[model samples]
Structure formats: structure tokens, C-alpha cells
Target: MSHAAALTLPFDTDTILEGLKSWAACESPTFDAAAVNRMMDIAGRELALLGANIDRIPGRLGLGDCVRARFPHPSGETTAGILILAHLDTVHPIGTLEKLPIRVEGPLCYGPGICDMKGGTYIAVEAIRQLLRAKVATPLPITVLLTCDEEIGSPSTRDLIEAEAARARYVLVPEPARPDGGVVTGRYAIARFNLRATGKPSHAGSRLGEGRSAIREICRQTLAIEEMTTEDCTFSVGVIHGGQWVNCVATHCDAEALSMAKRQEDLDAGVAKMLGLRATGNDVSLEVKRGVTRPVWEPDAGVMALYDKARYIANAIGFDIAHQSSGGGSDGNFTGAMGVPTLDGLGVSGAKMHTLEEHIEIASLVPRARLIAGLLTTLGA
Candidate 1:
């Protein structure tokens, strides 16, 4: 049967829109624990209406609950099923959502985090609703885990996510479909690191010879790091703040990095380059803290087996789905690295994430929701 035909809830557009509007009203900034919790509150209320039992999981750093809502089949079977993963945290701050609410600009639903994840969250809930209404009892039980810290690295919830994925036969991430509507089979493993350079303080003008400017040491190293970044690898000095005053020789300087690529060699080489950057001609104490986090998500035979199943699910939906790899990272990176059958970009087709122009397509909702619902209903059954 077609997804539209299989759907029992009639694809309630009003319901979805209302849910999105109500959700967008709340600011769910991952940077702010309170904000994320508020967004989770909105999610809980909406999920409750569908007869799902929602509970608050303890968060290490946030006020919002890492919700684990259960909707068991009447048969009471909880053996196994597809684990739907969608992060509730967004990169935007509290005011972005309300100040930048989702608007129908043409056929798009524009809002902060709408593309990167809020839309995926929408599809996750909507798909479950469709599946429940159709009375499709998954062969395995279904568990929907919405973590509040995905934007900042799973941190507290990553262990929980891995435990869940390890038990389930399949995992699906609704991180927003690609512009061409391609699903992601592989993602670059992400590693975030910070670097700081310290030096002697002396007058920049009078005692310039006595001063070992940490600022100068950092600047030279920045150039070396820039040289390390290549086409295949992406490394950025995303944050930089330092120095005491203009006249005095600045004693401190620092920079933060967000790094990624397909190969470990690339990441390691990049790290070595940063860590090996000694005090350039200056008398400075240069320090590089090794903070390599997150493993890579390469497509392996086992994950490929699961992709076959996903492709089959797509075929059943009157479409032939294709897979792609990405340099961006997600919790899916953690799971996928574990060799789970992880599929990403399973949400609505939208782009411009982490920016004010982010959006999800109104038209893509039904199709993507159908695809997600189908994956949930068919996998591991």
C-alpha cells in the first residue's frame, strides 16, 4: 500500500503545523539548559496527545528531560524494534525561535534549527502517530529517544543512546533530508579541541624586548594550522578571545577548534600540527590540550546490510532512495561508529541549518514522514 494509503491518521497537516508552531514558540537552545528543557516540555505535551507515555530522563547539564516515551503494541511485545533518534536541542539561543518563528515563505517553513533538527523531531512524532493509527505492531517494540544535548555532542546522553542502539536492530536519525532528498549512510567522525598559548608579560612599547607575546605565538601557530586544513579535511578556529590590554604585552591567547574528515590520519595529523607548534621565535609557554572526542562513522558491511533493508523500505514507498556521506557530525556518528545499522537525514528535506535561514519543506513532510514511519514499522519485524 502507498504510504498515504497506509497512514491511518490521514496525515493531519493542521496537527503537525500546530505542533511545529507551538514548538517553535519555545526556545530550545542547547547552550542554555533551561531553554532546551522548555522545548522538551512542549514536546512532551504534544507527544502525550498521541497516547504515548513520556518520562523525564535525568540530564547531566540541562533542565529539559531526555524523554523516553513508550508506545507498546497491544500484544505487549518489547523484544526489539527500530529506535528513533531525534535531538531536541538546537544551536540557536532562546529568542531565536519566537523572534524567528517558522513562517511559510513560499513552500518553506523557515525558522532556526528547523532544518538541522526541529523538522526531524516533527517527522519522528508524526511517523509514530501514523504507525500507531494504522495498527502496525512492529515485530520489535519501539522506543523514541529525544536527547536535549545533541547539538553540543551527546555528552551525558551518548551512553544512553549507545545502550539503546546496541539493543535495537536498527537506528534512524531524523536530521533533515538533503536538498535532493538523499539519505545519509555515512558521516565524518567529529573531534573538537581547544588550544591556548601563554607567554611572558612586558610592555609592548617600552619593554618590547622583555615581552614574549603569547598573542604573537598564537598568531604564528594559527597560520601553521591554516596550512593543515585541506580539501578533504575541515578544521576551523571557531573561537578566539584573549589579551589584557593594548599597551601591555599580552600574556595569554587561545583558540577553539571544530574538526572533521573521513580519515583518522587527517585528524591525527591536524592534531599533531597544533600540538607541535612550539613558541615561535618568542619566549612563550605554548600548551595544546588533547581533547579528541567522537569516533568516525564509516560505512561497513554490517551497516550496509541495514542500508539494504532501508533501500527496500524506500522501494516499498514507491521511491528508490539513495545514500550519501557527510563531513558534518551527529550522535548518529557515535552509533554508526559502533557498526549499527544507522540511517541519517531521515527527516524533512531542508537546509541552511545553524543559521537564521534554516527551514524545512512543507511538501516534504508527508513523504519523509511516510518513509520514517515505514522504516519503524518494517525494521526488525
Candidate 2:
């Protein structure tokens, strides 16, 4: 239920903050492949400087690249390396960096993608810096994976992530645990959906009785589906467009949305129920495409061990931190779901992800950097 405190080495807070600044200079937007590539170039250069052997792997659905780096023990033994996964692309756009640059005001660094992963990337990068500078070789080697499309559910880089994860003894995701600096032991699974309802269209005025209103039927299904949603799993109509003419009965109805589940069974139940519902007396058609890209990373015993390790380290460093589960999904979802001992929320904290309001707790920079350094030390031993 508890763990021993961890050990730490000396590192400069200023230098680490500078490292964060260097990362913020690039506008790594996941939606823009060009921007993603540019961010990859930046990550590659810094990782190379930190003594990692870097490579560029092509993406699945974008022009961006999955940049991977490895630092093997001098002995070249297969037994000694841990994989560090981070993403090069932030959720912010190209113009975001300009309008909202990294600024340390009070205890927060307000900027784009500051806490999501950019801040975490710097923590990982700096951990490498300290290790290299100290010439502290671990019993385990280290591999760093920086992807260009993490925000987009990592659709383009999941394969590479899984491949790298397969070889490592430990996996760390700097997803910015929480403002309190607690770690994430488990996160909800993600399921995206595209639902459509169809019906014949006719004049709304005279022939209303003869025509089947797709929009009306869709509204009914939407309400029915809305009631189907529960707190454990959620569904929504993010985008909906139906009807060609205002006076005419709508012929077609369509909607696209994202759904999430805290548990696998609940997710399945939600999806199954949504699909099973048939058209009502109006003779409407129903079609649902169920898509689950991210599996739920349950907080199983193995995952709990990693969080325990982090908690132990925090305690050792005079910080009593607790690990909690979240509704969000991270790269840890895949690795942990695959049965790897994984830990996430190791990045900076500032809240407001996927929005321009995203930022980092400036005060958390050095502490999180030290936290990561301490975590790596534990992994090495």
C-alpha cells in the first residue's frame, strides 16, 4: 500500500526551465503534418544532443514522422534499456506559439501545449541531459520515442509505439499527472463513433403523413441514444446535419462524435445497446459505425506497481503523492493495456489541454524534472 522514498541528484532548475523554453519554440500541431515534421526535427536534434541514436519512422496517415531514439548501454547487452515515450506534436497550432509564447508568470508558464506533452517532453529530455552529464550509466539502456500524432489518438504512430513498448522493461508517459503532482495509474478507454439515421423525405405541409421524416426519426434516435449514455461511458452528437429543404421532410440524417468509457464492459454495453435499437413505427433506418481506437488501460496490479514506485520515489523526495485514475486516455493506455507496467501523468501541470488556454505550472517544471530524474534512477536500479 506504500513505498520507500527515492534518491535524487543535483540539477539546476534554471537550466531545466531553459530546456522547456527550447521545446516551446517549435509549433508542433498534430493536425498539420508540416508543423509536425518541423517539431520532429527539433526533437531529433535535441535527443541526438542527449546521446540518443535517432531514427525517423514514417507515419500511418500523415506526412509527419515517428522519431525514435535509443541509448544502449556501453556493453551492448539486450537486458538494459527502458523506453521513454513522448510526442513531438502538441495539440496547438502553428500560430499558437506566436500568440501565446512560453511565459513564466508567478508559478505558471502560460503557453500552447505547455502541460499536455511539451512540458513533459522537456522533463524527459532533461532527465537524459542530467544522466549524460553525470556519466551515470544505468543497468538498463534507454529508448526515446517521439511521435508526431499523439493528440489525434496516435493513429499514425501506435504501431511504432507498441513495437518500442514491447522491448522496454519500463514505460513512462509525461502526460502531466495532475496539479498536485500525483501520477496516473489508469485512464479511461476511448471509443469514437459515426452514427447515421435515414428516412424518406416528402413535403412537410400536405404529404407529411405519406413521407418518412429522417430528421424527425434521427431526433428520436438521438434522444434515445442520449438516454443510453451513463457516467461510466459517455456519448454525444458532436456534429449533425440533416435536411435539404426547410419545408420538406428530411431524407437523411448523420452525426459524428466521440465516446469514452471508464471500463471495457460498460463501453461494450453502450455500443451494443446503441446498435441494437431499431427504427420505430415511422419506418426509419439506423446505421452506427463503432470505432474503438484506444483500449482501456486498467489499473491492474502491474500498473499499480509502477505507480507505487513513483509514489515511493515521491515519498523519498519529501513529497507524499498519490496515484489516481482519470477519464482521459494517454499513450500508457496501449502499453498498460498490453500488460506492460506503465505510468503516466509525469509531465507538467497547468490544465486546459486541447485548447489555447493550455499552459504549465512554472513551479512544477523543476519539481517534475526532478521527479522524472528520480523515476529514471529507480528504473535504472
Candidate 3:
């Protein structure tokens, strides 16, 4: 029997919309620990009500806490099972809800974090709810882990996420589906670094030769770094700061650099090149600090098997499914690289992420929920 034919949603569309609205109303920006904790509290309550064991794991390294919900197998089998990964935090700051209210207009619901992931997170919850209401016995345990620092590279939770993935039979990340309705099978490896240059300051006009400008040194190195971009690896210098006064030779300059690569070897080569850069000017010195390093999610045999199962589920619902690789990185990167079967981008369908126009297609909500429900049921079977 088809998974879709075997499953049914316990709640209606209105219930899911209400849940999303409640989540979107609470602005849980990644940097604000309190705000993110509030969002987690709300979700914790909902999951607790559903008879799942809820744990609010405290955050370390200046990040908000994470909430983990467990639906153990009735048969008490405790090997590895299904894992659902998501994030409660978004890029939007507090008070954003005032400008971008959670309102429904025709087929789209406008709000902060709705499309980026609030919608997706709730859909996962609803899928589990559907399975429970149908009294279907799950063959394996299910775990839902929602972290608070994913928007900021998951620095505090990377180890925890990897640990969970190590124990999971398969991982699913509902991070907003691609605009073309394709799921992500692979993702680029990413690295972040901070570059700083220091030198002596002097008057630009009167003592030009007496000083070596850090700004000039940094600019030269920046150009060299940008030139390192290739089809396999790319570099971006996003934030640059230098010189307080235009008439004075800058004593210090700094820049934030981000690099992405399609392969691990390319990323290693790019990192070595970036770290090898030194001050070309005589009086200037350079410093580089490494930031987060996200491994590439390369498609493997396990990933292909998960995609085939997803395609089968989609086809049972009367729609064709497609898979693609992305340049962006997610928690899936850690899991996929760890050799776990990971299927990402299995969330609500929408476009314009990380902007005021972020919204989800109202029409796509229920069907996608049904799809998730079907997948969960099929996996349990």
C-alpha cells in the first residue's frame, strides 16, 4: 500500500497555521539567548503535551539552550532510528514582528522565520502527531532536535548534532525546500576567518613615507584572496574595517572572510592558502583567526537510497520529486559527512529567505505536511 494512502493527518490545516503563527510571533534571533529560550519553551510545551520526553539542554559558549524531544519505539528497540533536525533561531532580530507581522494574505503567510524554518519545524511536529493519532506502531524510535544557534553556524551545538547523527539510522532536515521544489542531496563545505592587519600611523600628506598603512596592506591581501576563487572553491570578503580618518595612514585594518568549496580537498587547499598570507609591506603585520568549519555534504550511496525512498513517497502522493546540491551549508553537513543517510530541504516550499518578504505558500503547507507524514509512516513500517 502507498504510504500516503496508509497515513492521515490528525489535525487540520487551520491547526498547523495556528502553530506556525504562534512560533513566528516569538522572534527568536540566534544571538538573543532569552528570545530563543522563549521559543524553545513554547515548543517544549507542545511536544510535552504530545507525550514526548522533552529535554532543554542548556547552551554553552554564549548560545541559547536547545530542546530535544524523544518518541521512543513502543517495542523498546533502542538501536539507531530516525532523527529530525531543525533550528529555533533565525537571522531576524527582535521587534521585527512589528514590521513584518504574521499575517496571511491569500496563499502566503508573511512573517519572520516562517519560510526559513518555523513552518518546517512545525510540520515535523504535526507529522509525528498524525502517526500517533492513527495509533500506528513505529518500528523505530524518532528524535526531534531543535537547536538555537543554527543561523550562526551552530558553533555551540555542532558536537551535539554530530553525536545525535552518529546514533541515528537516518537524518532529515526540514530547512525550507529549494525554490524549484527539489530536496538537497549535497552541500558545499564552508569556512570562516577573520583577517587583521596592523601598522604604524602617520599623517597622510606630511609623513606619508614615515608610515606603512595597514589599510593598504589589507587591500592588497584582500585582492589576492579574491583572486583565489575558482569553479570548485570561492572566497568572499564580507566585512571590512579600517582607517578612522582619510587624511591619516591607518594603523589597523580588519576583514571577515568566508570561503566555500565543493570538495574537502579544495577547501583544505583554500584554507592553507588563506592562512599562508602575510604582510607585504615592511612595517605591517597580519593576523588570521579561524572561525567555524562546516564539512561538505557529498552525495553517497546512503543519500541516494534516502532520495529514492523520498521519490517513492512523493510519487505515491501523485507528484514527482527531484534532488539537487546546494552551495549553502546546514546541520545536514555534519550528519551527511559523518556517513549517515541524510535527506535535507524536506520542508515547506517558498522563496525569498532572510528578507522582509519571507513567506510560505499557503497552498503547499498541507500537502507537504502530508508528505512528511507519509515518509514517517513509511519509515516506521
Candidate number with greatest lDDT: 3
Kindly give the stretch of ten consecutive residues in candidate 3 with the minimal lDDT sum.
1-10
Best by TM-score: 3
Clashing pairs in 2: 5-316, 6-316, 80-140, 80-141, 81-141, 176-347, 177-345
Q: Write candidate 3's Cα lDDT for 37-141 as tens digits.
A: 999999999899888899899998888999989886765536688899999999999989888888989888999999889998999888887777777666678
lDDT of 1 at 330: 81
- The whole-model C-alpha lDDT of candidate 1 against the native structure comes to 0.76
Residues 108-214 of candidate 2: C-alpha lDDT, one tens digit per residue: 67777767788888888887787677666565677888887777677777888888888878888988767577888888888766677788877889898878887
Ranking, lDDT, top scorer first: 3, 2, 1
Q: By summed lDDT, which 10 consecutive residues of candidate 1 come out lowest?
A: 1-10
Q: What is the C-alpha RMSD of each candidate to the true structure, in Å?
A: 2.8, 3.9, 2.5
- For candidate 3, the per-residue lDDT at 265 reads 92
TM-score against truth, every candidate: 0.89, 0.85, 0.91
Candidate 3 overall Cα lDDT vs. reference? 0.87
